[model samples]
Target: MSETSDAAKAAQSVEAEYASAEQPPALDTDAEDVGLMAVPATAAGLPATAQGHFAVVNANGTLARGFGVVSSSRLALGQYQVIFIQPVTRSAYTATIGLTGSVGASPPGEIAVVGRAGNANGVFVQTWNSAGAPADRAFHLHVSS
Candidate 1:
């Protein structure tokens, strides 16, 4: 048989097989599959620590968007302070180098997070280049307790 005719026969076979295939149980797969995922019925058995606050800060320490964040400040160069509406002194602090927008990858750097010395609601963040010198870099902060 000619190549064109042979290709046409294969295409028709595929079409017939697909037409005989069964449809999934649901049309909206994401919504239907969500019910199959394991979700805790309650938080009673989980660890006490839970994400309570988060913030995305610009290199200049401007608040981008966040939950329970009051304000953000660029203290000096790579140092920043993020304040939340509630006290977070006892919460676990975490930070990572990031950008205020999702357009590009953030500069590779090191970040550290800690509770502010005198402010119960403040978190201290510091970013440093790979060489360890402080440098201005946007970051994301998370607080859990």
Candidate 2:
């Protein structure tokens, strides 16, 4: 038992098992259900829970949910309307509206429905054959479920 005192008692039992090791639990940002969950404004149809920009598809087999709105200002053409904080629960019938970013002219296909079907929010835009009647736009409206 004297090989340098048995290697100093096996290095003090491996430093007491690395000082009793046992740590991993330090992240409790005040814990009380921590964040984002209050979706209720008449929650209905395919993932409708009252937020914004949503999509939950699986069509042919059922289960669909897609709601949206992305907007920009400045228009001078015939129609250009908007609205939709969160309102697209039932009848949207594959709704869609387009035109995006830096588009100055000649970019406004069409989409003029989804105004109140089962409580939609709003929509309407123009331009397609109107060529480039009035510019400055960026719109994207969507609906499903």
Candidate 3:
């Protein structure tokens, strides 16, 4: 009879493979820039004054997925801006600590949102750890006019 691989043997094989592996790429947790993000053409037609739009932002200020969102940028530690295709000045904003991908629970943190200075179609977002220091966090943002 043929025998299946044992768990210990499989683990040893994996460890052997890892011994020759190169260093993994750096994580994006605190990346200064993720470069220019590609926005879908559909986002352009979205009215700047549209309501009920939302964005899922990654820890590095990249847009995971969003409706009526054009782009995102990391301005400073724990400070980011979400740019919309339409104006959000008359809209109410809400943000929550969350993940950009399917990864489980997010780290506990505080989030705040406000209108971007000198920009009507932008919203500034800030994140902080439980200790109230600047922190990188994934989040979801919603806007309702």
Top model number, TM-score: 1
Q: How accurate locally, in lDDT, is each candidate?
A: 0.88, 0.42, 0.88
Q: For residues 45-102, what per-residue lDDT tens digits would candidate 3 score against the true structure?
A: 6445446789999999989999889999888999999999888998899999999888
Kindly list the per-residue Cα lDDT of model 2 for residues 63-119, writing each as its tens digit: 133346433222344344444455544435333333332344434444333454333
Clashes of 1: 0
> Lowest summed-lDDT stretch of 10 residues in model 3?
32-41
Query: For residues 17-92, could you state the per-residue lDDT of candidate 1 as single tens digits?
Result: 9899987666687788887874654455543445467999999989999998999999998999999998898788
TM-score of each: 0.65, 0.23, 0.65
Better TM-score candidate (1, 3): 1
Candidate ranking (TM-score, best to worst): 1, 3, 2
lDDT of 3 at 49: 47
Taking all chains together, the TM-score of candidate 1 against the true structure is 0.65
Q: For model 2, which pairs clash?
A: none
